[model samples]
Target: MRRLHTLSAVSMALSGAISGLLLPVAAFAILGESVEGIDSSWVFVVAPLGLAIGVGYGIARYYRFSYELTAETFDVTSGVLSVQSREIPYGRVQNVDVRQKLVHRLFGVAVVSIETAGGGDTEATLNFVAEDEANRVQAEIRRLTAAIEADDGDDTRPAPSTEADTSAGDRTDSAEPRAARELLFELEFRELLLYAGTAIRPGAAIFPLFLLLVLTGDPTSLVPESITELSLVALSAIGIVAWALATSAISAAYTVAGYYDFRLERDGNDFVYERGLIERYSGSIPVEKVQSVTISDTLLQRLFGYASLSVETAGYGPGDSSGSQSTVPFAAESRVYRFAEGIAGVERPQFTSHPAMARRRYLARYAILATLVVAAAFLTAQVIGLERWYFAAVAFAAVPPAAHLKWTHMGYYVGDDHLVIRRGFWRRETTVIPYFRIQTVTTRRSLFQRRLGLASLVVDTASSRTFTGSVPTIENMGLEDARTAHENSRKQLQRTLRDRARDENVGLSPEMA
Candidate 1:
């Protein structure tokens, strides 16, 4: 059994003390009272008590937690009050991630997270381990998993011992030689800047603005009386512009910081990536376990002829955005496609567009939306005795172009062994899913789509769900085309799985006979 590095207790103590200090601050904020009035004398008492409790708890936790690697499983025993034990088999291990924040790096420690397929979250976390120990653990787990898989069900064969000798004291030696890594892609500083600049995040700006309001005590109070007297519509327009600018600046800064010095390399059958400046992350994605490959570009990125490529695996759930590793955060569209081809063994697809009725449907939807907005503005103007509200009717002019762009960008293609689905105008995405990896094929029709003789075809894989809630969908296809695609996908999936099973059986040893 191996315990965490000695410094882990110190780290935990610091974290616990910080959490304790924030309790009063949080309470004051929740009660809508200022924290500035707290007596200085109470700080001495509260701080010492919090520090003592934190130190005591940290020491206890350190003694209680221990982990060991055995022949078949990586076993962990943890918890101070309620002892819980977990045994994670090497065969089920999907990824071993090493993460280091600035403080952890300073302390010469890292966090190792072990993830398994369908786990949704990290299956096991070895927190605050020595950096060398973390690397050894990651390599050992990979070697053990590979060995197990290669054994081919020979149960009587003895498994190699992977347990490390804790008495050796911080040794980093591994039993097997590490695989040579080939550099596949690296983001240049200029490219990183471009990627950061293209990030559009209007929603992320709200939190900062809200925080400012909470801390400053009122938006109107910060401005002049003359500015506060502005019309509601004018004030809203100003606020929207301010929000957009704030969002762009903050999001760009965040992107640059998060993806600094990004690099992706191939180590045998796994793709390894390292990224980040303040909080570094190094993780691996097995090529064989990949469920889908996605190529996406935002409106600005498309305009700049840049796109990003990401790969998804079953080890992480849809809600875990970090699970989908972006192999190319920002690159020339052609470059992105080339990288995707090298990784997934698939080429750029020639997509077939949806029927013309789909365009009309989009136009109708936007036109109705514009009309409703104009009517709402007019009613509000009547109530408020305002004159310029009729300007909202200008939204009607955008309907045609918006509809055309949406229609033009939506298409799908069915290859011999893969399905390519493309959609979106503001942020276009193209997903490539292998037939063998597909879990389900579904077709849906809304009342409006049915009236237009159209249907939607969805191809779902184990990792199909994404941060944007976008799935592999061919929307507004002709009813017959949709039905044909659904049936063809199912047939192809079955055939692919059968062929794979047959191949596996043929590769089995003669001892089975």
Candidate 2:
């Protein structure tokens, strides 16, 4: 069954590519010869001639395919003329996944994949094995892993309760589809729309809309003439706003059709989500796979106590990672924080504050940058014989003071187990990282910072696996102190993570699995 699906897919891709080339060429060839038009001969005659070759390749690939899988290895053999086979070892297997497309669902079949560790490549799936075979292969690998684990005395820590084990089979972990768990959190059509509208992609409103405004429409009269050569800037701003509006409308229209009816559910600790406009996609995400949890706020969401949540799971694949952090996108802000609290299992979040910067400090930084601009304008005025009159007026136009507004927004929060980064004013953004997740930590001190005896700490999360928990720059801390703190914090965090895994094995695994 799986082989058939693979063959079908290869056939379809090849056929589609060939069809794309041929339709145009075939049309042009007949028309070009008929019209005797100036360029028509080349367009009509030559196009189809080239298209025929592509069509031939597609047909050949569709007809030739074969694959096989066993406990220790899986083999794939396929090609039109030349034959090829590749073998994969059980030790290298990192994950085994099952995917069911609409077409597969019709015949009760699914695509199975064998993912290996330590590579920027894939070597699994002798290309679409039967569902039972896929499950058998997954089981064999699990059985081997479990034996190794049991030899290591891991069986004392019972496996976590998974939605995949509804049926009691001989091999608990192997030879069966882990029950697909509903999402720990999920989103609805309406909420997904709002998220896609405001949060999914950054600068959705201002940047894209601005570009569209320039490309699609034009309006230069919107700027006031007396605003000191701000016409181009004004026109650009107007265009951006218009573009945002148009995209928003387009996004909303998609909301009604694509995800108008959707489902977000989880099984055990893994999440199962489904949504689509044309091609439907659904998958499972394990709890251990979750890398990060993000909560986003728009101006409106802030006031409404609503926010969007996004998570990057360990195995957070294409469709799994796209939704916002929270299963519920519109949850009140406090709810998200509480959920974060629950996920990290921290009751108290520590805080490290900075020396409050007064208006003086802000003006100091702002003025330094502002000085160059002021000098440039002053020199220009003198060169043009406007001297102190026009120059002073332009230089003292309160630009530095206006820029100073941004300075006050810089701050940081360092907790025992997490770091909170703060920057930007009107848009308040915050990020959190667990201590144990830090793969690397570094400290920096600028020339000015050296005078203040201060430094910033940059902690990078471990990216070895796909799960990226957190990364942040913590301020008002020295290199020695930061390193010491991180080391101690990590030791404590490791103990906690291990304890949690144990507790999960004892309490949650059986109940859920």
Candidate 3:
């Protein structure tokens, strides 16, 4: 279609200037004494050079990048030095997202990201187009795909349809209403505040303390010998408070930046999310493309009756931003469950806990780990001539209780159409994956598990919120129970495939069936 916004050049120039600023610091850090008397003014030269390069590059990129939409395929051609082109068929398009940074918003432009079913990362990104044009493009793609799916009666094929051949000029009228209608959920200001505040990571609280320990090599080293003991205590207290405030402020900004004005809505057959303040983003997944829905809550969230929800789609990867696939970043626990059930197309799954011996196993494992930690702490304290050796015993106090909670929380449910895995100690997560989405299944056992006649059922799907390339698991099931669950999942998968093939008039090979 059209080229990116003209301001793309300025954005590139700013990016280049930032990179240029970092060059001097990096060079100085690396060179140290080697260039002791070098003219630091030369660093100033780098920024202008970078800006020139960026401007030239941006101009070339704008001219070389172009896209064209055909009835069945969307073609994009990009590159300056080495030209690259791709034609993604409507059937192959997995997900489409629109994003806008502060500058782009000010200029009324947005970036559109497209992903495919075959890849974990974005296939193409259309740089800054008019915000309305971006929305029209996203909606048009969904409309064409949906029309193709309906006519073909198949999920994986593009069918010819007169309705899908509309020109870009007609797309605004044809697609905008479908995309903008049907509100499902939107975050209110109060809920947004709770979400931001409670979402402050535990790491943030510990980070300042960790930095102090690393920098000084000992907590007491923070107090200089020349300082009075009372002054030292006061200074330490103030530092802790300051770090706490800094951490809270950082967490709040991060949450607000990523999730401002968050809204989730149903656009035709797709579930769409639009959010962000400075960098607005709109992401969507077809209802059928969703593989699983997960609801999770931290210890604090539980107290506040809040939880977060995320959906797993075939093209999403762990490296993607956490908020990208989030359905509800933070909301009441009850509402989270309601949304999960609707999107996942299943009732809240009933779960069965692992056998009683699993508790003993967890207790044994935690006891040994805690014992080792306490021993290490005691030895360190002794070597440092520290008087807080007894603090190490605190480790022993929490171990058994945490182990008990972990064991109690470990459970799974093989339902009519979905399998649910529930686990985690403090931040509990419950994931519901449909059987049709499962790609593989296996069972594994550690030496200890084997001795205890227990096995872990590992189910895998193309979709994963965890980057480890694995899906939800049923761990520590008795051997017989594991086998039964494995067998049930396989049967359900076959049934789903067969039914799909029958409805689509597609023949599945015996292996697929």
TM-scores, all models, native as reference: 0.84, 0.60, 0.81
lDDT of 3 by residue, 1-513 (tens): 545555665665566556655766567556654767766566577646665666676667767887866778888999889999999987778788888878777777788888887767788887766676677778878877777777745555542223433322222233366435577778888888888887756556777677778888987666576766456557968987899887887787788888989887776677778899878888777776777778888778999889988877777764464448887888888878777766665666678989987887888888898888888978976765545556567777887788889988888998877888988867788888878889888998999999999999998887754422356788899999999999999999989777766653321111210
Clashing pairs in 3: 1-67
Each model's lDDT: 0.78, 0.50, 0.75
Cα error, candidate 1, residue 376 (Å): 5.5
lDDT of 2 by residue, 1-513 (tens): 124444455545666567767776667767766766546546555556556655566555554555544434556666767876676654455444555555655554455555554442445443344444445555555455443333454344333223353221122333444454333444555566565555423333455646646875853344454545344446657766777676676655544444543554544444444455543434333444444444456666666666644444332322322332233344567766665555544333444444433334445666666677777767865653433433334544565555454445455555655555554444544555555555666676777667666666766553332212224565556545666655666675676567656664311122121
A best-first ranking of the candidates according to their TM-score comes to 1, 3, 2
- What TM-score would candidate 1 get against the native? 0.84
Q: How accurate is candidate 1 locally (lDDT)?
A: 0.78
How does candidate 2 score on lDDT? 0.50
Model 2 bad stretches (over 4 Å): 4-52, 60-200, 203-240, 250-262, 277-279, 314-328, 347-350, 356-430, 445-452, 464-471, 475-481, 493-513
* Model 1 residue 441 lDDT score: 88
Candidate 1 lDDT, tens digit per residue, 44-74?
5665676677667777787788888777899
> lDDT (0-100) at residue 255 of candidate 2?
47
